[model samples]
Target: MIQKQLYFNNNMRQLIKSCKLGRDWKKNRNFHSYKAVQEDAKILVQPMHDSETRELSFKKNSNVLIQDGLLRFHSKDIKNNF
Candidate 1:
């Protein structure tokens, strides 16, 4: 087994690791001006879905839809609107 000494504690190391990854994470700010702003197109833009599965797709929450470069969805009060 290989043992390594970490400079930072577990939580500090995790925070720095997340910060390093965050540098590469970019948000699409020009979403409103997107040419094809359809749900299907939005889904295609992000390869976060499984190609084999025909599910509409979702993020952490089931009722939430992450599209148009934004997190959109109805609140519990307006959920019945759909």
Candidate 2:
């Protein structure tokens, strides 16, 4: 009985370690916004088009939305510019 319990404990520890590592890896691999503005628990993003880079800039109070397991940015400025 003691040996069985030890085996179960070891399996559980390994499972927990693997889960933690997977979560950490996912967090590190994901893209995160640089800054955000929030009001009443709502997020507002202000993105600008970088003329040199030809990509959306997220350096200025840019917030992101995560939908369908993807990061999305929504703004009239972004739509009009791009």
Candidate 3:
């Protein structure tokens, strides 16, 4: 395996190395209507799209749905929410 070296002992570098890199809304900022806004789209959009399985949106800590019409449910236990 190829090893990568870190240039600085920072929090961001640590997160990236762990394969758990994510955006922190508190530190980063963006512009709004002629001014800087406190609202962050990353809070809702980025993590929700990236972390879960493809082509589906689920609520916080919710179970993955299994429909009787889908083939994927045949292999999976329908009772299990995850």
Q: By TM-score, who's the top model here?
A: 2
1-82 per-residue lDDT for model 1 (tens digits): 1112123232110001101111212234443221222222222221222123121222222222243333332232111211
Candidates ranked, most accurate by lDDT first: 2, 1, 3
lDDT of each: 0.23, 0.26, 0.20
What C-alpha lDDT, on a 0 to 100 scale, does residue 13 get in candidate 1? 9
Q: In model 2, which range of ten residues has the least summed lDDT?
A: 13-22
Q: Candidate 1: where are CA atoms >4 Å away?
A: 1-62, 77-82
Better of 2 and 3 by TM-score: 2
Lowest summed lDDT across 10 adjacent residues in model 3 is found at 11-20
Note the residue pairs that clash in candidate 2: none
TM accuracy, model 2: 0.23
lDDT of 1: 0.23
- Model 3, residue 36: distance off in Å is 34
- lDDT tens per residue, model 2, 15-46: 11000011111222244422333221222222
By lDDT, is 1 or 2 better?
A: 2
Per-residue alpha-carbon lDDT of model 3 for 51-80, expressed as tens digits? 433122222222221122111112121222
Q: Which regions of candidate 3 are displaced past 4 Å?
A: 1-54, 70-82
